[model samples]
Target chain A: MKKIYLALAVFSAVAIVIGSTVLSVSYEPLDEVAERMNLTGENLLGSPFPEYTIPGFPCWAGGIISGLVGGIIVFAIIRLLMKVGEDGGN
Target chain B: MHIPDGYLSNKVWLTCYAISLPIIAFAYIRLKRKMGKMEVPLFSALTATVFALQMVNYPLGPGGTTGHLIGTPMLAIIFGPDAGIVGLSVILFIQALLFGDGGITTYGANTLNMAITASLVSFYSYLLFRRAFKGEKGRVISGGLAGWLGIVSAALLCGLELGLSRATFGYGLNITIPVMGISHAVLGLVEGVITGFAVYAFGKYKPELFSR
Candidate 1:
């Protein structure tokens, strides 16, 4: 089960990388359509990571990185909550 | 479908908030009463997983906007409807406030369509399908169908809301409904497959999770 979880994690990471690449590459045309449709909203679909404006990091990359980091943080919080629950029970 | 702030009219968004708030409150109370302590981690984990999965936006069609997995059905199936509501609400809230994926003003509308409607419809449909069918295959089929149906139902509701907003704005049902309906109908298959596979795998590895 542990091995399976590890494998799934690895697979998800790789998939995220590949998926991000594909989405970034293919995003332009769809973005154009969204702009035309006026779906971009207030900031024109602003980068998820607003603070990190490094030269090398693009918007899509920021989105992908922020998503992954957010997922990890959420998972960590879940673990902490679980621990608290367990402690309370004991 | 992550409807931004400006998409919905004030009346429409306010109406959605009015409808959703009570449901959310009810669900939260029910979850607090019904859920076991041990279930907390699993529930939170699953919710976070759904939140993470929503980030992966698959391109819908040529020059069309992308659609990500809404996992409401899967969450409802694994947890109960109440938990599903809570989970989706949290995810949507975080995404809106932090990421700005959906608009702060339109959060209620998005929650109504994606969380409440999708979860309830999927839960009932899954129960119906599971009862009609038989064993392991039945479970998989039911989950897949529920996932697909849930998405389409949410999409339809979203379309209706968008259409109604046209009275204040200009985008009518003729445009909004057809576009949302068609795109969601196609994208829903992916939801089905993902839900089916996840349910099947869990059924195999952790059958106890669903025994209740």
Candidate 2:
């Protein structure tokens, strides 16, 4: 019980630090490392690399929401999956 | 690292899917067998924790680029690799489907690098080092090295994938492998420290989480 609270407190603190752009500096996505180089995409089959960052929510908001919402979703789904497994994949 | 779409050639991506699918299935099977004691609260907490942590991109010194935690190492160190793999797979799935952080096409590759490989390496390395060392301080040090090794191994695998994706990424093995490997080697230090602290914290609070 104490561990849970500690974990949540730590998680929320991390979420706030990373989610708030003011607190954390943003870095370029790793995939784009190629873009910064002299190499051109024309050599590859897909000429233009795609951008796949999160949409809509800011980092902090998304972090908090996912932590809260994802916890419930993951628990329910994992439980359901276990039940199905016990039922022989019915 | 999350390899986006169009970064991997069909051959590379497909091969990754083929290789990763079986391993993930095995992890799932293992997870199910132990589901009763699976510790969903901790797993979910860590999953969301890592999900948010992955978003925090730290600058990689003067390289004009950045890196973030792969995190499976810490999870593996605490809860064993099987749970670590399962949890990371879930995080990557959400990141791809909802956040667009990774690609559906590249998921296999991403999972292969960040989850499966990272957890395995982290877990085994910890075991190996723990056996070689003793006491509380040694355990924390072992955890740190295991974390470093895990992320570095993932980076190396990512480099290999990108290197193989010369037909798709326009970078040959020489370019992609070294960049990914070297940069990650540096970034892995941070992983090592975090993993060590995680080991310390867990040992102090939830010692039961550590597997025998």
TM-score of 1: 0.84
- Backbone clashes per model, in order? 0, 1
lDDT of 2 by residue, B1-212 (tens): 77877788999999999999899889888877774444765666666677666656677633666778878998888877887788888878766765556778888999999999999999999999998877789889999999999999998999899888887677788987778888888878888998898787877777777646
| Candidate topping DockQ | 1
lDDT of 1 by residue, B1-212 (tens): 77777777889999999999899889877776677776776677666667767766677643565677888998888777887787888777767766666777788999999999999998889889988877899889999999999998998888888888875445788866776777788878889988887778777776776777
Off by over 4 Å in 1: A1-15, A24-40, A43-56, A76-90, B62-65, B167-169
Q: What is the TM-score of chain B in candidate 1?
A: 0.95
Chain A of model 2, TM-score against the native?
A: 0.39
N/CA/C clash count, model 1: 0
What are the DockQ scores of the candidates, in order? Answer: 0.29, 0.27
Model 2 chain B: worst 10 consecutive residues (lDDT sum): B35-44
Assign candidate 2 its CAPRI class: acceptable
| lDDT (Cα, tens digit) per residue for candidate 1, span A1-90 | 455355446545654565456643334222342455666455234545542122367865765676677666666654553354345554
The best candidate by TM-score is: 2
